[model samples]
Target: MVDVSAITYDALRVAAEHVLAKVREGEELGTEDIFILYLGTIVNELRDVRSEVARLEDKIDKTSQRIDETNKRIDELAKSLSARIDDTNKRMDETAKSLSARIDETNKRIDETNRRIDEVVKSLSARVDDLAKRIDALQTTLLEIQKLLIELVRSRQ
Candidate 1:
């Protein structure tokens, strides 16, 4: 019997081939062969899931970068506006109406930036939470599969 503990993809493939050869010779598949077949199928599914996780991770990274960039731009704009307000204050002879208008516009921009930031934060948090759950699920599935395979291997021993 093949050592299930030492099983790798290549080894499993060879074992499968051997089992098939036995079948062709009108022999029944061994217990190890049955377990290997089941694991092979699960491995294929896991491969696909792993690829999807990678793709999502990349997307999250890009999105996070964009959010950070946007937040930085908003901060810079707020700083610039504050500077402009200070300059406006220094020139008291300037029209009061114009100063008022500028302050109002700055407030509006600040409010909008804050709103956008909140939205981005919420979106990022939701995405992270979703990813965490998916990762947890994946981990659980992998552990469960490992347990089953280990049990099968141990049973043979």
Candidate 2:
């Protein structure tokens, strides 16, 4: 009727080109979807990393507080121990003084006892000398009586 074969061929060629263009557009859309997915994944990772960092920072702060508390406790304990040691030293000093006084008193008593012993020894030595002198006098009187008896006997013979 109006050259139907040429018109049909031209229409088929146009439809084929439209199909190819649509396929290309679909490929581009697929690539854009993949890119968006990748960007979302990166954003999620960054958020997770930030959350982890915040948690770590909180933990560090808590640890620092705990360390400070421990140090304060240690300081308090050291001060308490030092006070106790000072009290003990004071008591020890008093005890040492008491012991020294007792030792000094003991030494004084010992010196007094020695003096008494020396006095007693001098009295005994004097008594011993008086007894020796009396013994010598009695021996001399016995010898004189013996000599008188011998003279009387000779006169009678």
Candidate 3:
């Protein structure tokens, strides 16, 4: 039961070289040497797998960070748009109030002008009535003077 993690690359290389030399010299491989070589191959494959897993984990961490940053920016933009909408609503309300006040003022002025026109019409009607009475009195006086002249002319002849 050798610790697989504890075996170094140098040690594995030396073992492989020794095995190779023994084979070349026409010697038989012991069971222990074959087991060590098999363990070395397994350790090397496991190291490669671990390195690939670490690379994938690093990539996943970077993608997660980018997603978080994008979410933050989206939240900030939404808040800004909300603030702008609120400001526009306030401005529109103020403008509506201003226009309403101006309309009220204009109505008041129109009502005042109508009242002045009514007063002028009433005064003119009264003056026209007085002039009509004076004209009737003058016509009656002229008719009486004409009758007197006609009677005096007949008595003289």
| Candidate 2 residue pairs in clash (backbone atoms < 3 Å) | none
With candidate 3 superimposed using the best TM-score fit, by how many Å does residue 57's alpha carbon deviate from the native? 4.1
Q: Name the candidate that leads on lDDT.
A: 1
Candidate 3 matches the true fold with a TM-score of: 0.55
RMSD of 2: 16.9
By TM-score: ranked, best first: 2, 3, 1
Mind giving the per-residue lDDT tens digits that candidate 1 earns over 121-153? 999999999999999999999999999999999
Name the lDDT of candidate 3: 0.88
- Full-model lDDT, candidate 1: 0.89
Better model by lDDT: candidate 2 vs candidate 3: 3
TM-score for each model: 0.46, 0.67, 0.55
Segments in model 2 whose C-alpha atoms lie over 4 Å from true places: 1-39, 143-157
Could you give me the TM-score of model 1 versus the true structure? Answer: 0.46
Instruction: Write down the lDDT of every candidate, Cα atoms only.
Output: 0.89, 0.81, 0.88
How many angstroms is residue 157 displaced in model 3 relative to the true structure, after the best TM-score fit?
7.2
